[model samples]
Target: MTPKLELRGVAKAFGEKGSPTRVTAVRDLSFTVAAGELVAVVGPSGCGKSTILNMVSGLYGPSEGAVLIDGAEVKGPRSEVGFMLQKDLLLPWRTVIENVEFGLETRKLPKAERRRIARAELRRIRLEEFADSYPYQLSGGMRQRVALARTLAISPELVLLDEPFSALDAQTKLVLQKSFSRTLSESGLSCLLITHDLQEAVIMSDRVVVLSGRPGTVVDTFAVDLPHRDDPLARSTLPATQAYVKRLFDTLHIAEGAA
Candidate 1:
């Protein structure tokens, strides 16, 4: 079967089309995510991780190589793909359900149909009771859950999450991570999570890919072979969990004391 997502000999550069100042952000990078798999990419600051996401999302085309989803080239943003950012990016004027339905508004979907899907998504996230509440009224974690619901409302075949839980408090972050893991598994969704947290990557991903320093390239890859992969708190206490964490830190040359 074709992979859910694939990048072939992918290289990206920035600056003018023919300027000496142009800098290459990524070079000879390639990877693939199978259907229903969650892959995490972890790298240092300014590693061009977001660059890869933008290229895959069709927001920006790579200078060389290709990004293909479901065996088709990603020429532009398509409904089959969903992107969730660090911020909720919910409109305060719009209620929770309204925010969830916002993406479908441009699809020419019927009003009743959009509402039905949005309501179902809210129910899935256990936020049906707050469907009428505005963004400001919900806690940070709740807002993020609504954001996740919004992403799912469109029924994306693949989801790209860029630091989705980085903004929340430690406790809230862990809880939401577990919830997200369970939801994604139950939904059989394919996801690519971009996070800086080594522990989060180990706990949430089926595989973790570490990138080299700036102008990033795939430096190392590790498979997370732990039971109950969705439980963030429980996974943290496991010996294998620390083992993966240690390996990642070692690859990045980050002192264990600093991590």
Candidate 2:
């Protein structure tokens, strides 16, 4: 079966070709995320982790190779892909339900229908009581949960997460991680997550892909065999989980040292 997302020998470069100032961010990178599989990418800073997401989301075209979704080449922004960033990026003016409905609204969904969908998503995140609350009215973790509701309202086939929980406090981060992991697993959404946190990668993903430094390329990919994937808190405390984390750390260290 075709993978849900595929990056075939992908490379990205900035600045004009042959120009002295040109810089290649990632090169000869290849990976795949299968349907309903969550893949985490871990690498040192400046390894072009975010660059790869941009290419996959069609925000930027690859300088070489290709990005494909469901066997089709991605030439531009795709409706089947949803992206979430470190920041919530919620509209301050909109209420919780309204923020969740933003994407549906863009699709020209009828008001009642969009409202219904948004409400259901908010309920899923257990923020139904805050339907009328604005982003400023919620805590950091709540705001991110609202952001997640917004992302899922569209029912995208693939979700690209760029350090989505990196900003929260430690305790909040763990709670949100478990919640989000359960949500993703239940939704069966294919995900490609870019994160610096090795433990996060190990706990929340089916597999972890490590990249080398600048002009990033895949150095290694490890399958996570721990149980209770949806319950990240439980997974995090396991010796198996710590073992995976250590392996990821060593891989990253080696990659950085070689760079």
Candidate 3:
């Protein structure tokens, strides 16, 4: 089967060609996310982790090579891709359900149908009780849950997550990680997550891709063989999980502070 997503010899550069100020964010970066798999990317700051997601999401085009979804090139954003960031980014004026319904609204879905879909997503995340609450009324974790619900409401086949739980406290981050892992598994959605936390990568992903610093390129890839992938919290505590984390730390040279 074709991979859910593929980046072939992808490179992205900013500024005009041959210009002194030109910078390359990533180079010769290649990877794949298999269907129903979750892949996490970790690297030093400015390694273009988010740049890869933007290319996949079609927010920006790679200067060299190509991005393909299920064998076809991605020229621009498509309905089948969903993106979530570290911030909840919920509209303060909209209630929880209404916020979830925002994407559906943009698609011009019927109001009743939109409500039905949003409500179901809210229920899936176990936030149905807060459907009528505003963003300010919910805790940080709850708001992120709402953000997740909104991302899923459109039923995208693949979700690109950029540190979606980094803002939460340790306990809350674990809870949200478990929730997201379970949801992705049950829904059979493919995901590409960019995070700085190696532990988070090991606990949440089936495979972890490490990138080099600046002009990011694939340095190494590790397969996470922990049991119960859907329960990231449990996975995090396992000795095997720490082993993977340590391996990642080693690959990234976290202790050496290599630039």
Cα RMSDs, all models: 2.5, 0.8, 1.5
User: In model 1, which runs have C-alpha deviations exceeding 4 angstroms?
Assistant: 254-259
Superposed by TM-score, candidate 2 places the C-alpha of residue 144 at a distance from the truth, in angstroms, of 0.4
Model 1 superposed RMSD (Cα)? 2.5
The models' CA-based lDDT, in order, is 0.90, 0.94, 0.92
Assess candidate 1 and give its lDDT. 0.90
**lDDT, residue 202, model 2:** 94
> What are the runs in model 2 whose C-alpha is more than 4 Å off?
none
The positional error of residue 52 in candidate 2, measured at the CA in angstroms, is 0.9
**Candidate 2 lDDT, tens digit per residue, 147-178?**
99999999999999999999999999999999
Task: Score every model by TM-score.
Answer: 0.95, 0.98, 0.97
Question: If the candidates were sorted by their lDDT against the true structure, best first, what order would they fall in?
Answer: 2, 3, 1
Query: What's the CA RMSD of model 3 in angstroms?
Result: 1.5
Q: Using lDDT as the measure, name the better of candidate 1 and candidate 2.
A: 2
